[model samples]
Target: MRPAFVAALALCLAALPAQAQQRFKSSAGDLVVETVAEGLQNPWGLAFLPDGRMLVTERAGRLRLVSSDGKLSAAIANTPNVTGRGQGGLLDVALDPDFAGNRLIYLSFAEPRAGGNGTSVARGKLNQADTALEQVAVIFRQMPTINSNMHFGSRLVFDRTGALFVTTGDRYGQRDEAQNPANHIGKVIRIRPDGSVPADNPNKPGWQPEIWSIGHRNVQGAALHPQSGQLWTAEHGARGGDEINTPKAGLNYGWPVITYGVDYSGLKIGEGTAKAGMEQPLFYWDPSIAPSGAAFYTGERWPGWKNSLFVGGLAGQMLVRLSTQGEAVTGEERLLDGLGERIRDVRQGPDGYLYLLSDDAKGRVLRVRPAP
Candidate 1:
């Protein structure tokens, strides 16, 4: 071959890997992962609209619409401002249960304050024809903004009764705040669709009325159990001891006071992982998988995966599946090990397939289906 011909052949071969589909075998069946959309910047959240389109959030405070066939629209207009510093940025997106009539949507983001930034929840009406949000309002803001940008735990989930559940972090330097219900930091709050405190919330004395549960470190993932309707969450640990807990009203989850993890410097954490009056994790991982977004697999695409809980792993770069028997996690499986991309968020699409958003500057939204 001539030199020019040989060079062209080499370039073509090098580009093949980038466009190839990723395949994996799991308990469900032979799986094929295809890139549905690309060019997203650190995509953080995924929500499907009633019309089968997808609403995605990028960590740098942009929202984009993805068509059913994988085409990505330009960033939607009038998104809330976000800090985008450290672990803070645009976080989660959730649609109203009655979105067909209301066209309402909710977003979680790191709002910039005077001294620092804190997690805030906002909702607006999505105007599809114009591709902009209308009447956007900040409904809830975490209290006591701190200087550090790590651990802005934010995930939005609506319970069976249509109330909203918002998870929060301990704000990095303030682990002790997890045990304090007086503030929104390190707590899971339950509120009405219009951001009002529910009258039935466990209103302990001196605690914020919005607080539903306390003592969380950095709860990055939350889902409503498909069968039992309980709220399950996944939180980060220091060196080891990532946890999955079923948070209940007025319960403490024992973050700084009792942890299975140690300090980043290898020193032991408080109380050695067990303490009285604090709830134990339903499941936990040692050495830390850095779990993020989560969802319950009630879809029919994978016959064997019904009722399974799926969690995205950032540091592990895999999808974590937990087999649950009622309230207990019976088994665990890690998928997409070979692709080696950080899974930022996972959701079950209306078509009954699993959708994943990769966390990267040049991120892609992937769809998982059984191979034909």
Candidate 2:
């Protein structure tokens, strides 16, 4: 091609969106990332409707719908009042397993309370025709609401047994409460669809009956392992030492007592990363990626990526792909680092492709597929 023609082509390519031209290669194959929708304000969670539309939660306490064709809808009405404080707000969304018939959806948010704010879960039916929630009810609320805004560990996932698992944080100022089973701070709680505690829960006498696990800092990412059916979570550390744990019934995850990280001021944290009875992480990162949403890839669209675990990194600004062998992570790959956007959530679409939400004032939903 002539030099003048080549110069014009370069300018055209430069004008295209970053995702349009940026490509990455994974163990599966060459991949391309493209923005599906934009203009979202610090979007956090995403769930799909039966008809292929998406329900997304904004950190500022708005829930909106995005059609399959990428059209964004106005905020759905009847959402509860949220604190929207630091690191808190409307966080995660999940549809009922029987959503088609029940029209039920669950939301996890930092709820405004009398003393202050706390993580709470609510369920409501989607009145599609009216664009509002019907029968909205707060199903569960974290105990002893505190004034702090940071560390509202809120993520929602449903197991095959129909129990809902909700993650809560240490409320920043209440890290010590993570070890206190009586309170809901910094814990994972499993409850029934109607907000009742399960009979088989491994509950301590004085502890909250709904708690499944404890000793977590701020768990924001959670999903079920596709094959093992175990619950896995990713939590943020103080300054460094981000961790991924497979939380189990009545297990202690060792947050303030045993951490791989230190205080933000570079002080030691909890007895130097190990203790006699505390559970260790399946994987961890030093220098902290600040991981958020997670999903296990079981789709056929990327054959080689099957069974992989995908985690979004906020501070690291990338998509983390962990190749798994059974219950253990065998390898890791970081995708979309060149895009330089804080990835907030990752999910596998029903169409078998990977989807992500960017965290920013002008956040966007992104789709990933095999390059042509």
Candidate 3:
């Protein structure tokens, strides 16, 4: 997902429950949460198979498949080794637009390099015989990889045009790289499914040329709005400035240069929150929700939530629902606060239920629906 904007880990006092503890009220009132699967460790991302099964990724670099009957399969072993320190590990997973016919999938992970780790995306065909992946090959890689252990910003989403989008972190010390088109850090890159640059992108003289927009800090959550066919992303702010942005082609998002968040030590970031050349966030959270995963609701089970945006919060330990009217965030609601666990990802399943993954050693996948 977006670069991690999380607080340092504190001593594990009392373990939080793996499931939500109370009935949450939305506009419809009284939300019900049920356990779909359990006994997962740091479940990171999830994508639904065409047959209504789910493919899930774990940060420790294991991939697992869940059948429609909620049976968890053995870990798929072909996943490459990951430098699973801090935020570096296996991250987001996605299915090809034509996965039903193609049986292809994509994954993002922290790749170990000479100096340190960099993010990489690979594609493969899942062979159902042994439930393992085959013909896996890296399609994209970040350049000039750094030595830091944080801010990988590895999330994947496909647009309506069949192009793929990938997010990169600024490597903690290189926040300014987000503003430099010549660098891949802190940027959302657009590419063809086979990892080639699209010729129509805003070309820079000596830049990587795949960058769609620059000046992003760390983006973990991305989804395509069903109605407008537009892209939306959520990222962690420094301390208090988490943001939700509507990304546009050739635009600047103004990360370190303009931010609503102060440093963790309570110091100012840039000159101010606004800059002449930058696009504004659709909505920003002042106290920082530590946004991790997001999905636009298009499930038939919740018809009233058809156009809403669902986001998972790590630090805030909640699910956020935003009512959107043509990119304007008109209303906000919180769900599953009583869960007491850090939410890592949110996805709408093929069966029309909303699924969530918790970010803990004993993390579990949960389903939410209207109470019977």
TM-score of each: 0.94, 0.93, 0.93
Clashing pairs in 1: none
Residue 351, model 1, lDDT: 62
- Compose the digit string of candidate 1's lDDT tens values, residues 164-254: 9999998989999889889988999999999999888999998999999998999999999988999999899889889999999989999
The clash count of every prediction, one per candidate, is: 0, 1, 5
Task: List, residue by residue over 242-288, the lDDT tens digit for candidate 2.
Answer: 98899999889998999998898898977887888899888998889
C-alpha RMSD between model 1 and the true structure = 8.4
All candidates: CA RMSD (Å): 8.4, 7.4, 7.7
What overall lDDT goes with each candidate model?
Answer: 0.88, 0.88, 0.84
Query: Which tens-of-lDDT digit does each residue in 94-163 have in candidate 3?
Result: 9899986788899999889898878889888888673788989888888778888899987899988889
What pairs collide in candidate 3?
A: 1-220, 2-219, 2-220, 3-218, 3-219
Off by over 4 Å in 2: 1-21
